[model samples]
Target: MKKNIKNKLNNLKASDNYRVRRAKDSGNSHIFRFKGNDYLSFASNDYLSLANDVRIVESAKKALDIHGYSVSSSALISGYSRSHMLLEEELSNFLGQEKTLLYSTGYQANLGVIKSLASRGSFIFADQLNHASLIDGSILSRANFKRYEHKDVKELESLLNKCPDSREKLIISDSLFSMDGDFAELKELEQSLKKYEAKLLIDEAHSLGVFGYQGRGLVFEYLLNKNENIFLTGTFGKSLGTFGAFFSGNSDIVDYVMQKSRGYIYSTSLPIHTIEATRASLKIIEEEDWRRDKLFSLIRYFKNCIKKSNLTVLESDSHIQALLIGSSADAIFFSDELMKRGIYLPAIRPPTVEEGKSRLRISLTVDHEEKDIDYLINILDMISQNLVQ
Candidate 1:
């Protein structure tokens, strides 16, 4: 059995798909220290750069003094605290949702939400490249799962048309495709949902604190609140620069999920300090218009740099940019080459992305300036020239 495991591991290395972690000898930021050297990080998801903000840190410290770390039980038991209630209320108000339920992680939030709302007789239509958590949740729910092409609303509608069940019909997708860094066709998807009378669930994990008025998210931007059939999930670990996640929508549905979600019910709740810290982050997210402004500025600057250099960049106007370098081997080579030049963007290989679609996922944060982006572009150009030789 050990021999078989060894063989599989060896196979991954040969395929150039073996993964390894680079231990950052520092905290979260646009500059990461690894192996005793500082490298400009184009790999962080801390969009608003709030991970190390003093206000958030102070808030967490205050909560620690009052609540003393972990809540020590599940939300339903004795774990839910005043901090949790306040955070939930704050998130609900920020997102303009009727209710919200917190989960330990974004994956858990997706899993709990999907399984709670879907069942054996239900039909779940998801995007082909929806996050793995969403895909897993659909499968685990014992529902009839159908995947439409990425951003193909017509295909989704066709599938919805073919399903002849009176049971629940739920459509799930990411508000922003994480790897591709493209916004979902929310306007089209909403029209499809309305036409088919289907329930819509969107994971705003990557878009939270990055878009919409005051970073409320795409659902708010697209004006998708016609009814209670829409559900939204997002995480604080990315754009908000904190931890934990949530599923929010209509009051009745959220309450039902809180009661029925096995993942939420079985897991210990988030620590009070983390919840309090998220509250601080949300307050900053709501008030800090300059952070968003600076990030979008970086996005535009980076895109122009890529274009002027004639680099192969995927279609993305958001903070997440995909620099598509064809094969896994070439992608790895490019990543290593970039690291040698003091930039720490890594190769994103399959199955995170399609084979031959391996690329470097560049994440822009407010902490980065124009010079930082210029350096990245110059290094990319240098690497491209070397690759040609």
Candidate 2:
């Protein structure tokens, strides 16, 4: 088994698709340290720059003083605490949902929700570009699974039309495409769901704390949260600057998932300190409009800068920006050149993205200044020109 693993790794290295972890000595806001050198990072998902906020840290410490870290068991057993219930209530109110349930991570939330809701005789219509968790969940559900083209509502509707009305239909998609940095058309999707009497499950991992009023995410922004058929899931690790994830829906759905989700029922609850820190982050997300304002401003500025350059960037209204570099080797080369100049933008290759569509995944945070964006544009332009020559 060890020899076979080594051979597989060798094949990956030859294909220029092998991945390795880079240890960071320290990191704060938009900067990270590696090998004793600090670099401006465009690889983080900390969009609101709240990951290292003093208040959040202090709140976690306070929780630690009171709760002493580990819950030690799953929520169904002995791990569920008053603090967890309070956070769930707060999230429910904020998201305009009847109830909310916490999970260890975004991946677990997606897997649990899909598997719990879908089974034999059920049909899961998923977007082609949905996250791996969603894909895996659909496979594990043992349901009739079908994937439609990316963001093509018409194609989704056509597929739905072909399905039998007797079976349960669940439509799953990412509210924001993580790699492409584009939004799913929730309005059109909701219409299709209503027409077919299908249920909707959306993963808002990249949308929460970044889009919508009070950072409630794209569902609320599009008024889809009021739709009883809609179920929303989001992660705290991204914009919330903490850990864990949540699944929100009507009371019945929440209760059903609580009883049925194997992932939530079997795994230990998140530490109390992390939940308290997330609470602190949620408070800031609701009250601080200036953070969103600054982030959107930076996004606009970055897009404008890219427009003036020769780089081919995907259309995105969110914080994630993808600059296409065509091949895995070219994408890595571009990322390496930027790292040499004190910028840390990572190259995203298959199967994270489609083959021959490898690119640099640039994540912008509110902590980044206009000048930092300017520097990035210059570096990217220079690298692209040199590569062309």
Candidate 3:
């Protein structure tokens, strides 16, 4: 087994897809300190730059003085607390959903929801570029998994038409594609749902605290009201600058999943401090309109800079910007060259992205300024000038 593992590792290295982690000594923000050097970072998902906010930290500290650390058991057992219940309620009210349930991570939430809702004899239709967790959930459900071309609601409807009418049909998609940085055409997906009589599961992980009406999410932005057939799964780890995740829908579906989801029943609950911290983050997310304002400003500046530099950028509806570098080796070289110039951005490679589609996924946050973008564009322009195909 060890020899086989070694051989697989060698193959990954040979493919230029081996990944390495760099420990940042400082808290997450626009600048990350690593090995006694600081780099201007464009790699964090802290979109509103709240991860190290003093207000959130103080809230966590207060909760720690009372609840210590983790709850140590699942929500179904001794782990669920007033903190969890209150947070769930808050999220329910915020998202305009009838009910909500907390999970250990976004991955667990996706697994629990998809598997609980769709089982054997059901059909799961997903976007070709849906997140790995959503794909895994569909596979685990024992459902007939069908994938359509990315954002192709027409293809999705065609697949739905082929499924038996008596069998349940669930369509899974990410509201925002993290790697390619595009939106799932929710309006078109909704039309398909009505025509095919299928339920939709939209993962709003990347859009939760940065998009929609004051960050309610894309579904709200488009539908203006929750549809009975649409459910949402999201994480606090991204724009919220916190940990844990959640699933929300109409009361009946939420209750059914609560009873059947093994991931929710088997995993430990998030720490009380983390929950409290998320509450504080939520409050800030609602009140601090300036953060999103500043973030959009930086995004526009970055786009202008990229346009002027004559660089290729994948279409993005939100803060995530993908600079296409083509191949894994070339992407790595671009990332390394940026690191040498004190700009921290890592190459996004397969299987995070498809082969030959590797690129630098730049995450713009509230803390970044126009000057920072100027410096980055200058470095990228210089690198591209000398880069060999």
Candidate 4:
């Protein structure tokens, strides 16, 4: 029976693709060691390098003294605490929203928001390239979920028009496309949705601390009406360097999510220490504007370096920069070659990216230096030339 199960597992693996996690013992940066080789990691989501900050560590330790390790239950049960409430208040004020609700992860936030809002007879218009969590939530919502082409306002408008006149409609999109790192046309989307009288939802999982004047993401970046019927979701796992997610909107939406969103109602709340750490991280993001500036400068620096290398790179103003290699085998080979050179960049292939457009996703942070960027450029230049040869 065990042999049969192993054969079934092997068959399942052969049917698609499988990926394994490599161990690392360090904080955020492009350079890390794994399997006894040092590799330049261009793949972490810690955009601001606040995850391992000393100040955050101190705050977390303080909270641990006050709140203990685990809450032992979901927030609705016995997990709600003063620390969680304080962070919610801070997040609400920071985002200019009426209220904010927290979840254990960004994926759960997306799932809770979609599954709770769009129900039977409701319509949900999602971007073609929305995150898998959003897609899963829409499917599980039992609503008439429609996907428009990515960033196409006209396509979204047309789909909204086709929905029954009496049906409630919600349009969902990522403010920053994670894989591509391009921003959504929020102004156009807002206008189009208003024409159809449908509400809009923006997931700022990649934009929370990385965009806008005050780092409020695209909502403020485009000057959208703050008190309008728009929903915004952000994650601490990325820029905030914490381990939870939050959704902000009107108070009623918060109440509804708290009461009805299964993902939130059932899941355990984030640790109190994490909440305190996240609050401190947000302060760092606001007080240390230089970090953001440094991040952008590094992005520009790296982009220019790649351009000087005469390599084709995706047009991205965000922290994520990808180099299209066009085949999984090619991408894997490039990543392996870079690893052998003591520079690590993991291969991103089909499922994460399209089969024909396999590319290297490079995540930049303030922790990386000018020399690190230069070394990466040199390595990529050599790899590109050899691949062409």
Candidate 5:
């Protein structure tokens, strides 16, 4: 067994797809220390820069003083607390959903929801470029699943039309594609689902707390929240700058998931302190609109700067921007060159992205300044020029 595993590992390395963890010595809002060197980081998902905020830290400390780390049991077995319930209620009200159920992580939420709602007779229509969690969930669902091309509504419509009207259909997609930073046309998707009388499950993990009025996410931004068939899943670790995730929908769906989701029923709940911290983060998201505004400004500035360069920037309006590098080795080389210049932009390669589409997944945050953007653009220009030569 060990020999077989070693052989596979060697194959990965030869293919330029081997991954290794690099330990960070220390870190701050926009910089991290690795091997005694500080590098400006554009690889983190802390979009709102609330992860290191003083208020959030203080709130976590207070929660820790009141309730120590873990609940030590599943929510069904005496792990649920008032903190959890309050946060759920707050999220439900904030997202304009009838009810919400919490999970230890976004991956688990996607797994549980799809598995619980779909069965042998159901049909699941998924987008091809959705996050891995959604893909895994659909496979575990034991339902008849079909994936449409990325953001191709016409293809999705054709697939939906082929399914029988008597069968239960679930349309699943990420409101914002994580790697590509592009948006799924929510209006077109909603219309297609409505015509087929199918249920919609939208993963708003990237869009929440960064888009829409009061950070309601792209679903609400496009007025899809008005549709009763739509369900939403969001995480606290992204824009909210904490941990855990939630599934929001009508009261009956929430109740069904709570009672039937194997992942939720079998796993321990999120720590009490984390829940409290997330509540604090929610408050910051609601009251602080400047964070979102500044992030958008940085995105615009970065895009405008990239327009003059030879590098291929994908069509994206979100905080995430991918500069296509085309091959695994070249992407890794580009990332290393940037790091050598005191900038930390990680290479995203195959399996995380498609083959030959490997690129640098730049995550812009509120903590980044205009100078940071300029520095990145300058470095990229130099690298692209060298690659051309």
Candidate 6:
């Protein structure tokens, strides 16, 4: 037993990648108290900066008062609440879907969708750069999995042509890529799916409340809102700045998952307070369009600044901006130096990205001001000119 574990542990240590934990004080932005120094983070996925929003917090508190704490059992086992039902209804209306099914997390939602849909002989066509959750879910489905080049619908068409006529096909992808900030070509992909008569599953983890009319998502933004064979999975963790997740589709599909998906059936549901806060966050996204505008403004400014510094900015037209630093050591050093100057963004390294492509994944929020962008620009310029050395 000792010998069996020793080889695996030793391999991890030898890889220059021993994972560790650091405590963070989550109540503030630009003020993570770790190891006696405050660091401003760009690593968090809270894009709208609504995690600490006063109204959301108050709504959560009110829900706690009304609903109390523990959801002592699964939703099927008496854990379901009025707030959960309301949120599900609101999501269905917002997404223009016939129904929605809530889950404990985005990861679990992806798993449930794939495991339930992709049967033996079914084909799962995926984007090469899709999130790990989608990949894991497809593998777990016991289906014939095929991956195409990222955002290349032509390649996807070719793959679809090759599949045997005996099996059903499901194509899965991210609406907005998590790391690269690139977007899927929705219209083209839809055309390919039509040619093959395949079902589509889109994970809108990064795009919801960031694109489309009233931030409904990329699906609505692109006028693909009424596709009957399309399915969508989204999370409150990103733009909504809350917790939990949901999947939206035709009423039949949603009901089937509700009755059959093991991930949904086995797990306890999200707390009442979390559901209430997510509801409040969605309300804010609907009524306040200016936040989306402000985010785009900052994105444009940052891109212009990155260009002036002569740094390579990857081709991403979304809120995520990657400044390629090449080597992991250089990326790590650059992140550390920025922290020393009271600016913080982590170096995304191998496994998170392809080797030799480590980068600084700078994310913008509605709460970040023009001045913050200016400061980041100055620091990046200084680093490029070798001043940080």
TM values, all candidates: 0.98, 0.99, 0.98, 0.95, 0.98, 0.95
> In order, what lDDT does every prediction score?
0.91, 0.93, 0.90, 0.84, 0.91, 0.86
- Report the C-alpha displacement of residue 358, candidate 6, in angstroms: 1.6
lDDT of 3 by residue, 1-389 (tens): 99999999999999999999998888575888999999999999888999999999999999999988878787787998998899999898888898999998999999999999999999999999999999999999999999999988788888988888888999999999988778998998888988889999999999888887778888778873479899899999999999999999899999999999999888888999999999999988888888888988888888888888858788775788988888999999999999999999999999988999999998889988899989988999889888843
lDDT (tens digit, per residue) of candidate 2 on 1-389:
99999999999998889998899998856898999999999999989999999999999999999989799999999999998999999999899899999999999999999999999989999999999999999999999999999999999999999998898999999999999999998989999999999999999999998888899999989988898899989999999999999999999999999999999999999999999999999999999999999999999999988888888689998899989888999999999999999999888998899989999989999999999999999999999999889
Tens digit per residue, CA lDDT, model 6, 222-286: 76768988889999988898999999999998998898889999999999999999999999998
Name the better of 2 and 5 by TM-score: 2
Task: Flag clash pairs in model 3.
Answer: none
Better of 4 and 5 by lDDT: 5
The worst-scoring run of ten residues by lDDT in candidate 5 lies at: 24-33
lDDT of 2: 0.93
Residue 111, model 1: lDDT of: 91
Candidate with the larger lDDT of 2 and 4: 2
**Candidate number that wins on lDDT, 1 or 4:** 1
For each candidate, how many residue pairs have backbone atoms clashing (under 3 Å)? 0, 0, 0, 3, 0, 0
The reply for model 1, stretches above 4 Å from the true place, is none
Answer with 5 or 6, whichever has the higher lDDT. 5
Clash list (residue pairs), candidate 4? 30-41, 39-344, 40-344
User: Which residue pairs in candidate 2 have backbone atoms (N, alpha carbon, C) closer than 3 angstroms, thus clashing?
Assistant: none
Give the winner by lDDT.
2
lDDT for position 210 in model 1: 83
Off by over 4 Å in 3: none
Can you tell me which runs of candidate 2 are displaced by over 4 Å?
A: none
Clashing pairs in 5: none
Candidate 2 Cα RMSD after full superposition onto the native fold (Å): 0.8
For residues 179-261, write the lDDT of model 4, one tens digit per residue: 88888888888887778888888899998887876577778677663637788888899988888999898899888888889
